[model samples]
Every structure is written in structure tokens, then in C-alpha cells.
Target chain A: MPDDQLSRVFAALADPTRRDIVGRLAVGDATVGQLAAPYDVTVQAVSKHLRVLEDAGLVSRTRDAQRRPCHLEAEVFDLMTKWIERYQRQAEERYQRLDAVLARLQDDEQQQTDPDEGAAS
Target chain B: MPDDQLSRVFAALADPTRRDIVGRLAVGDATVGQLAAPYDVTVQAVSKHLRVLEDAGLVSRTRDAQRRPCHLEAEVFDLMTKWIERYQRQAEERYQRLDAVLARLQDDEQQQTDPDEGAAS
Candidate 1:
């Protein structure tokens, strides 16, 4: 119901059932009946899951006779990928910077003690 | 807490405030007070967000004197990226298969009409 696509996408995938449905759709499109066949839940419940996926733009549907086949829209995944990658890269860079700083400090400390330990070496 | 790491990670990121906190932490680690400076929320609320992030394995923390610095765990993003990519690739492959099938159907139709249309050509 919200316009925040990122949040919607994450929330849409928070449930295992929804994730499973997405997986099945990825292999091929299916009507709600077909998607619900393997689940113990009612068709109405499966329909609700489809609605959530549809709202998140992770899925789309088209009318074919009386059936509305749900299709996976892989392009929607780019949004999540970009967001996750941006943060992941930043975090990794920060960790690398910290490591570099620690290495520099160790080098500085070694230099400071080099003259004192010259005879020992 | 649920043992579902993927769900927890997704649920943690479902909130805009939490996502913003993650984005900030990605750039560098920060204390709760420092992290709370940019947001209108209280330090307690920010702490709660941090706890959720910690539970989701998206963040880690260390005690330094009286301060606890929160660090972003970028490796957790791989879980999400892998899940999203799996479905995206499957969907793309399915689309390609469908296209190939359609192309073959067209070729078969063309072959059937070739014998009759020979004089017209």
C-alpha cells in the first residue's frame, strides 16, 4: 500500500511463503490456482500473497480467459541489488580503511622502537 | 527471536529509518549517540533499531569505555543478494526459453507454408 518501493520489496519477501511463490514464478508463470496447488492454504490466501507481490512490482499478471497468470518481473530485483550493493561496498571500504589505519599505526610504533631495539636485532 | 535470518534481515530493512541507519553505518561505525544525531528519534529508539540490526546480523558492536560503537556487517548482504539473484536468473532463463519455443513454433509454421508459397516467390 506504501509508495516506498524498497521497503515494500523487502517486506514482500519477508515471508517464506512469498519467497517460495516468487521462486515458483521464476521458473514459469502460473495462475493463482496453480501457484496455490502445493500449499495447504486456501486459494484466497494465495491470492493475497500474489497481491503483495504484485504491489511490490516483483510480479505482474495478465488476463488469459478467466485465469490471471502471475509473471515474475526480474527487473524489479535491480532496485534491491543496487541498494544492497551500495551499502555492502561502503561497509567493506570502511573495514579496509580501518585495517589500513591499524597497519599504519603498527608501522609507526615499530619505527618509534626501532632505535631502542637496534642492539637486540 | 525467529531463527529465520533472511526474514529477520528483510524485516529489519523494511523500515526506512532502519535502512537509513544501515546506510550511515556502512560509511563508518558510530556510537548510539552519534548515530542518533541525524535523526529526530530519541537515542532509545535508535538503540532499538540497532538491536534489530544486531539480531539480523547486519550489524555488530564493541564496547569502548562507556561507548558501544556499531559496525555494519557487510557480509550479511550476500544472503540477500544471493536470494534475489537466484530468482532473477531463473526468471530470465525462463523468459529466454519461452522466446526460443516461440521462435521454433514460427519456424515450423514457415516450413509448413514454404511448399505452397513456392510459386508466389
Candidate 2:
């Protein structure tokens, strides 16, 4: 996915209400009314949240005029997953390297201490 | 881990510049001056981005007053990874279930058509 689209996806999910809406939609598609039922917010408010999700390509609405249920677009998650995993893996590897260096230093210290202990004994 | 922190993390990465900074930091820690070098933006601007990242716990600055290199906290990625993976898995399972239903319908249609072929033969 393009950087702009990725930015939109991240921005969309940044809101807790939108994230909750997405969590519910993952279970199954739901009309805006059904989605807004649990929240104290107005349907209009929920609709605005859906607009953000739709713009981010994280959710889609069916053509049915009467009851256009919101469907979660699972594929977009792959884009985010790929981006996040790449950096996550890189960071983890760096940490692992740091850990190795620290371990080697500790081993050297132990070796030095072992010889000192022998001399003292 | 907490919803607020997750929100901050998502919001922090929403900007392309911030994400790029993060990608670079994952490879190794860098001072704000180093991070600002690649972009046309000022060092102060890069510092602002780092502030957002620090608030989100995605990046941290060292105590050194002269050169506080930013470090990528890989653990925060775990929080985002878990959130995304949960919803991604849910949506995928839902798709799998829908596919199963469609497959069953196709099987029934084939069975119905087979009897007609037998009668015609």
C-alpha cells in the first residue's frame, strides 16, 4: 500500500471508537444503527467514524440502499501488518545484537574475576 | 498495552515522516540531528516528531545531554501487532466460514444438476 493510504489506515484506527467499531465488524457485518447501539454517541457520530474507516479502505459498505451494512476489509490489514512487521523484526534483531554484545562483555568480566579469585585463594 | 497508548502509537505512526524516522531508528539509534538530515524539515521539526513517538512509547531518548540518541522500543510493536492480529484473524475466519457456506451451496447445486443429467442420459 502507498504511504498515504497507510497513514490513513493508522489515523483511522487511532480513535478508540473507530477501533471498537472495527472490532465489532470483525465478528460480522452490521448496519450503522446496530453498530451505534452500544455507544452513547449519536448515529451521525458513528457514521463519521465509518467514513474515516471507509476512506482508509479498512471498511466498505454494500450497495443496498435500505440497509448498507459495513463490511470489514481484512486485506488492508495485510498492508499494515507487513509494514509493522518489517520494522518490528529490524528492531528485534538490533536488540538481539546488543544482547549478544552485553553477554560477551559479561563473560569477559567473569573470566577476569575467575583469575583474580585464583590469585587471592 | 492500554488503549490510550495504542491510540498514541497509531497516531504517532500516521505521519509518513514519523514512520520513516521509526524505520531508520529500528536499524540503529540516531540523534535528532542525524534523523533530520535526510528530510528537508528542520531539526526542531524532527524533535517534535520524536516527541510524539516518545509519548507513544515507540521511541526513547537517552539521558546524554549532548547526544540523546533515539532508541526504538520494540515491545510497543507487540501491542500493535497483537491488536492487528486479533482483528485480522477474526476477519479471515469469517471469510473462511463464508467460503464454506458458498462451497456447500455449490455442492448442492451440482448434486441437483447430476440427477437431471442422469435422467437425460
Candidate 3:
């Protein structure tokens, strides 16, 4: 539930062609035909991939006369970034704590192994 | 071609169980057995999930005597954030240009529809 948007974004990027589509759309808007021209896949297949990207909120379409141009929506990227950064920060904080605990444990072990080492020093 | 690390991270998060494991590890590090106890799936299944997360660089394990405890690696998240943000920024800049063109087209249409509207106003 928490990962709904991130899930969609991730799933959209899962396919290589869709990722390529995204890469192209990133540079500028393109019609389905224009976007599909570079690939061996049928226009229908490209359409399907665009549909997935659209559903994922990564792509948006607008009518340009007879052609429907797809535009990439960059704001949705923040959804994934927020999610990633949250967990990343959490994990790093956990790692820091783990390091502290490990250091304490090692110090305790040293104390046990060499009780007089501290006194000698 | 641009999505190598992003793919791994997305594919890793595609599994809910693994995402849950990540969430848990985010709060604190846990042993494999501890991570497995909450799920109905066998310890083996959870172990496999951990392996997936491990391969994706989302999770790391450290030996503690006979037991291996998994810790979340926050650094890897940057790889994905970078990718997502890059395309996102691209799309947004493209959008600005598209918007400018759209506004120009709208102005042209207005001029054509009411030829003397500009002169009258």
C-alpha cells in the first residue's frame, strides 16, 4: 500500500523498451509512431508499453491535431526519490547504530581478554 | 542501458515480502531467522528473498560467529535516485518547451479565429 506509486514507477521501468521510451520522451514529446519507429516491435506493442508508462504516471498524452503526443511527467519521480531516500536514510542510521554497538562489543571483548591492558596503558 | 542498477532495485522491491524485509531492516538489523518468523513462508523462502535483496545491494550480511545478520546498505539507493531524477529533470525541461509551443499555437489560433480582434482591441 505504501509503495503503490513507487511500485508503478519501478514496474514501468522494468521493461527495457519502456525504459528506452522514457529516455526518448525525456528529451522531447513524440507521437506513438515517432517513438515506435526505432524499434522492431509492432506499433501495437509500443502502444501497450506506452499504456503501461501512462498508467504508471510517468507519461502523459495530449492531442496535437490527428496525432497524440506523449509527454513525460517529471514530478512523479519525486515519489520514488522520497521513498528511496527515506529507507536509505533509515538504513544508514541503522548502520551507524550497528557500528556503535559492534565497537562497544569489541571493546568489551578486549576488556575480558586483557583485563590489565587498560591498567597497563 | 541506463537502467542497470535501477532495474535491480525495482525488481527487488517488486516483491512485497522483500519490501517488508527492507522496512524491517530499516528500523534495525535482524538475523535471517528473526526476519523469517513473521511470515508463513518457510525460512528458506525468506532466505531466498534476502538473497535477492542482497544481490540488489539493498541488504548486506555480516558474520556474527555462526550466524549471519543482514544489514541494509543505504548507499545503493543513490543509484536509483540518480537515474529517476535525471529522466525526471529531462521530462520537466521538455515540458517547459512544449508549454511554450502550445501557448504560441493557441495564440495563432486566436489570431486566425478573430482576424480583427487584435486590431479592434
Return the TM-score for candidate 2, rounded to 2 decimals.
Answer: 0.83
Q: Sorted by TM-score, highest first, which candidate order results? A: 1, 2, 3
Writing each residue's lDDT as its tens digit, candidate 1 over B77-114 gives 99999999998888888888999999999999899888
Tens digit per residue, CA lDDT, model 1, A17-116: 9999999998888999999999999999999999999999999999999999999888989999999998988887888899999999999989988877
**Candidate 2, residues B1-121: lDDT per residue as tens digits?**
2358999999998999999999999999999899999999899999999999999999989967898888998889889989999999999999999999999999999999999989998
Residue lDDT tens for model 3, B34-87: 999999999899999998888888899999987789988878878877777788
Full-model lDDT for every candidate: 0.91, 0.92, 0.83
lDDT of 3 by residue, A1-121 (tens): 2347667777787677888899998998899999999999899999999988898898999998989999888778787777777888887777789799999999999878796776778
Q: Which stretches of model 1 miss by more than 4 angstroms?
A: A116-121, B114-121
Output the TM-score of candidate 1. 0.92
Which pairs of residues collide in model 1? none
Ranking by lDDT: 2, 1, 3
Judge the docking of candidate 3 as incorrect, acceptable, medium or high: medium
